[model samples]
Target: MLQLCRDASGAPLAPQGSVVCIGAFDGVHLGHRALLARARERAAALGARTAALSFEPIPREFFARGTPVPRIDDARGKIVQLAAAGADLLLLLRFDAALAAMSPEAFVEQVLVARLGAREVWIGADFRFGHARRGDPVLLRELGARLGFGVEVFPEFLVDGERVRSSGIRAHLAAGDFDAAARLLGRPFMIGGHVVRGQQLGRKLGYPTANFRLGRRTSPVDGIFAVRVHGIGPVPHAAVASLGVRPTVNGTEPLLEAHLFDFDGDLYGRRLDVEFVAKLRDEEKFSDLDAMVRQIDLDAAQARSLLGVPEARPAGACA
Candidate 1:
């Protein structure tokens, strides 16, 4: 079972001599994977379990109020990814004021030394923790030496000569460069949600769609996209997707809708995972329904071509 440690509350659990990596791991990008790999390698060598420690409602979210932040994945998704990466234990530490107020020494002594029994610690060069972000790689090394633990700080991971980072991935997604973002993420960017009812606007336009209510924290890629829908059959199907507040329809809440290339079925309440492939265009308003239909036709053609769906029908065709 996965263990989630929240705040320095109650009695500390006895350490099992684990090799751990610590980070926000927002996107679980290549950098995160590299750190995890190192941790896993060290754990195997030392005969210790591999674990990842991260915070929930990330520090930035706590500081940002309710403003929409560019999050590649939510806490649940982070845990899933970490577990898939061979984490024997996953700790979802609740980032409250009390935990945030711990001094560097206290954090290392209480969390790392006492609770986690960290035999080996791995992190990126830029990793920081403790009160006021005073804990750097050097500080961790110094503390490790005193605490009788090993510390490994890895150099930044690079892709195409550019350092792969969560911020860089967010920037690429914001600009609708899903392909570039995927290259850094080591897989296509995917958003999973349960299908929900919509205003039937797509149906009226001759293109029925599966509407999805994204999680509270999702990336800020608000635009039309070429996507692939998974969880329906042997292979994912090509799709055209829209993400954002529907300005033309005067919609308030953000919505994610995907129209499959050649699929016809009721998908209400079904879980859908949409893999973003390419950005077709930015969302725009049309003067009339006819104009909107025409633009959607063009968007569908572009999405199909980008997704390599050879038999994709035109926009107005029935699925």
Candidate 2:
């Protein structure tokens, strides 16, 4: 389990011997993994707890007022992924204007040195912090020497002969290249949300679906995809998902509608983690209901095949 802490008075909570990694850690992608692995190794050698310090709303989102910015995952999902990466403590800092106004020295003295009691700090090569983004790895190294702490900066990580980064991943996902994005992330790109009630038009079309309203404004891709729905159990169910505003229905907000293959049960209010396996097709507005139904059938077959779900099963067995 990871503990969340908030401090603004420059008061130390943990003992003065923690190993900390500071960043946005939005996607927890391969680049983040490299930094975290180094932090874990250093923490073990120094006999200190490993902590990841991150911020909510990200600075860009906070400043942009929910403009057209791409987010790989929400804050909650990021915490869950970071916790799974072997962090002992997860610090979610509030990124309001007050906190953002702190100088580089104050940030180090108050947040890193005082509140977390950080004995060692790990960050990426391009890491920067404090008011107007004045802090840098070089500055941190100098400060660490005077503050009686150590600083380690990891080089940029590469994937597919390109520098791996959150922005690159977002670009690939936006272009509907899930496989390339997955290679950079070391896992499938996933969207999680609660199943909400829709217009039930799909049910009328003979293809009942569960609709999900994303918690974040930015989604990676807007298309139909073959996906795996988790949070149901260990075995991920095969499904076909549509992510976009329904032009045919004249809907306004972007939505995700997933039709589970060979499954029957009410999923209303149940939170689902939908992992994109492959892009089936870009979202399109069909001329008629019959055309849409035909395309959905094709999508279902492709999704099942892509997920490796057996075409035939034993009698009375779920597909």
Candidate 3:
């Protein structure tokens, strides 16, 4: 079982002892998994639970609220990935003004020591935390000596001579490079959200759709693509998805519109994981509704041909 905590003031998760790993873990990529695996190994050796401490809004998002800073994954997606990556408990500390005001020492004493009761702390080589980003591996070791917790910092993770990072993944997605993005993410980049009501435009055009609102200003990727819809049934359903502001409809917020291939049922309000397989084309506006519908038909055919039914599985699955 995975225990989830949102409040630092809540009951202690690991009263006995815990091996703690902390990071934004935005995509819970291969680099992040390596660190979590080490925590799992240490926890097994020490007879302790593995706990991951991460911040909501990822600090960067909170700090750059009005700016168009897209995320590799959403909160719910991050939670699922963390548990799959071997975290027994997920401590999603809410990043608010109060937490932002807390100093490094206070954060260690109150959150790590009191709430989590951490026995071992693992972090990435360049991980930074606490108010004004004053916390570091050296500081953690100093606190560990006094608090009886051990600290381990991993070196920068690299792949193909480039550091594996959320930013790198975002860049690849923006460039419509699914292969490169998959390499960095360790899996297909996906948008996970509940199906929502749409304008029925696709239905009117003979292409029924499942719409998902991202609740974010921008997306890491914005285009029409061949995709797989997961968490909808026992098997992944093939689909064609458009991620953009629906220029033809004069839509504002970026939305994910998935048109499942030869499958239908009520999906509204049901959570679905839309996994990116291949970029078909960039989102574009048509001269009219008929033209738009024609384009969609062509897109569907291309997607079906590209996906070829049995999509090759990525190294990891979206948990």
* lDDT for each residue of candidate 2 in 182-261, tens digit (9 for 90 to 100): 99988989999889999999889877898998756578788899999997777988888899998877878999999888
Total backbone collisions for each predicted model? 0, 0, 0
> Each model's TM-score, in the order given?
0.91, 0.90, 0.90
lDDT scores in order: 0.84, 0.85, 0.88
Better of 1 and 3 by TM-score: 1
What candidate 1 gets wrong by more than 4 Å, as runs, is: 1-7, 10-14, 310-319
Which model is ahead, 1 or 3, in terms of lDDT? 3
lDDT of 2: 0.85
Query: On a 0 to 1 TM-score scale, where does candidate 1 land against the true structure?
Result: 0.91
* Candidate 2 residue-wise lDDT at 71: 87
lDDT against true structure, model 3: 0.88
For residues 1-319, could you state the per-residue lDDT of candidate 1 as single tens digits? 5666665544544355889888888978888888888888888888787888888888888767887677898776788788777777776788888888999899888888777788888887778888999999899999999999988877889999989989999898888788889999988789888899999999989889999887677566888999999988889988999998878888778899999988889899998789988888888887878988899899998887887877655789886
Answer with 2 or 3, whichever has the higher lDDT. Answer: 3
Cα distance off (Å), candidate 1, residue 114: 2.5
